[model samples]
Target: MLKHALLSLLLLITIHTSNAATPKGPLEILRHSLVQEVFAFGIRPQDTNWFDIEVSTNLTDWSRLATALSTNATAFFVDDSATNAPTRFYRLRIPGTTVAQQQAIWTELRRRTYTIQVERISSSGKYLSADVTVTSGAKHISNVKDPLTGEAVADFDPADFPSIEEIFTKLEAAAQTGIYDLRVWYDPKHGYPTRMIQREISGMNSNVTELRFNLVER
Candidate 1:
């Protein structure tokens, strides 16, 4: 009976620690690891200088998933999006930050089965903010929020601004134009963006659009 009790206590401790924002991995060095189908983990930003996420099939011939991914948010890039290889491996490094970084930041955010706030800002000032939710793994602005009270500004509404998924779509489309710059910051725990900015830098006008996400927890 005592042996069973001790085993149960150990099992509970394991379960609790496994879901921690910073979960331990089989490896000592690689912090981010898989927990079931979901890939979730957190990394401090200081360690993310020029950081990147890379994947491999047999732990060799690594290909970068993203570069320059802001480590402030927990890292959560999906590993199955590419070819569905037999075995997949992932590693986070701080040596490169580039287009791959943007890809890595946006990938894990397909949806966490939750909702959050999206704030839009520009040089002129704040434009709009809304409480947005995920539907079928896509973001939809449910209702605008009150800036003062931080409550939903409306009941029934039209989601005017782009959703996170939509923003990624726009990002991919705009990449070909070669006329803009995108900078993003996300929560490293569940992989939610805290802020994203896109600036049209080709011409003199230099219009900047920023989205800030405030996660709403139940």
Candidate 2:
């Protein structure tokens, strides 16, 4: 009987030691500061396990940003449409896991995810300020420019050319009306454009010329 008890205690100690080595989930922020939108990417469970992405302004009263099952890589976006507050915090909650597993999950998540925040804009609207809040990331920003004039092109109208330059026109119009295009990019590195936000605006003026994007750092 004493031999059996010693074996059980040894097994318990082994299990505890193993549990202490697990990893946690990572917190990646796509947008932070001077911007209203945000994105978080992390490894979530597949189906059997469950996780919750929580956001808080005060870090006390937490709100659910998203909920998922298992630790599969996933991305989620949130807009401060309801409340325009500064400094938002986010965290992940994983149930039915050892602490070591949580740490490993977090490390992998950080490796794959990066957090960035838009800082400020340049005077001439040629360049913008980007501040890296975290580590392990890369960022680039470019725009459509007149080949001959070397100036940022801001002539195309969304209403006039809805087919060829539909996205650009819509965004330009939005910027003209005091609504900012927080996610429109023409990256020279990638040789393509991508839209991060899609919304309509009214009462735009035609004299609006330059558009600027401030990329946040990770």
Candidate 3:
């Protein structure tokens, strides 16, 4: 009987040792801070799993922020949208979750007030561009110029210039139609499109538009 008991105890110890060696999921936060109104945080994650990052202002309604793959090393993250919020909270959700719709980035941008310079190039080879400033109540556009001439547009119609909102609308439509060759790049911090190119390949409309945006002031 004593020999049998010793064998059973050895088997249990072996199982526990094996289980402890395995890495676990759900990343752990190491440190976090708000610098220059941006949320900067560090996390230690298991190499075996991916994590969904979520953030909130009230801590009750969480919004999916981003997804990250763990490398078993310390990782750093930033919340550029934090600049507009007075209070912010964040967490690392469980593995296997997916990123939410693309609209999240636009939502982040709505909270900010900034000035951006836009450069436009179109199929007609003529484009009116300007530096645009947006605030709480009104939009201020200045330095309106014709890129084709590299001169100030003496008689510029604001309606002829596409705003950021309009660019996004065009992108969304292109995405849904599945007919245009579209390539877009976004600002890492603000999540707004920094560059976009759309070429209509269907031969129905051979319009190609290229837009480049640069943040001038926050």
Candidate 4:
């Protein structure tokens, strides 16, 4: 009887240690903004191809918002353009995973990169809201040609390509010359394009021109 009890105690100790080493999964709140909300959690990479995320004010009740996997997932919320709220909470649930894996996932997310730029139309109408000036790159323009017609492209007036004092001068110039806006926000670490906004110039019409760009580019 004494030997049996001693063996049982040792076995229990081993089991407890093993359990402690495993990870756990639980809800995580990523960000809260007036315009946007973000939440995320971990799911086993093997068990499910995607995660089912639910949001609710009260923990007892929930509503599905998004479904995604460990690598391909975006769990976020946005209020209607007209209506904005103050505070919100989010929750996540996944099977066959522990909370620790979820926490590790969040840590990985923090390493993602972000870039923000705010542009406004200037009070003056003659110039663009923002200007980008560019200098000649290492490769000079041998001869400008219209890619569409295979005809020699006319040189833009000096006013069209202003001198840039900073790195963004080239970008600003490109914007002014009606090249693809090419404005992009990216996460270099993951090689993911987070957001992009572009405008295409249709042609001169009275005083107004038209443009286009993708806000979300995968």
Tens-place lDDT per residue, model 3, 97-167, is 32223346655656457777888788987687898877773677889998777899768666545556666
The backbone clash count of each candidate, in order, is 12, 24, 0, 15
Best-to-worst ranking by TM-score = 3, 1, 2, 4
lDDT of each: 0.51, 0.34, 0.58, 0.30
* TM-score, per-candidate, Cα-based: 0.44, 0.26, 0.46, 0.24
Lowest summed lDDT window (length 10), candidate 2: 9-18
Report how far off residue 133 is in candidate 3 (Å): 1.7
Model 2, span 23-47: residue lDDT tens: 4423343332222233222332322
Compose the digit string of candidate 4's lDDT tens values, residues 38-136: 222222222122233344443455554432223213233332221222323344334312223333443454322222221222223322212222223
lDDT of 1 by residue, 35-107 (tens): 3433433433333234455666666677655433332333323333433443555565544444444557657
lDDT of 4 at 83: 25
* Shift in Å, residue 143, candidate 1: 3.3
Candidate 1, which segments miss by more than 4 Å at Cα? 1-112, 137-139, 146-160
Cα error, candidate 3, residue 56 (Å)? 32
Off by over 4 Å in 2: 1-21, 25-48, 70-72, 79-82, 96-218
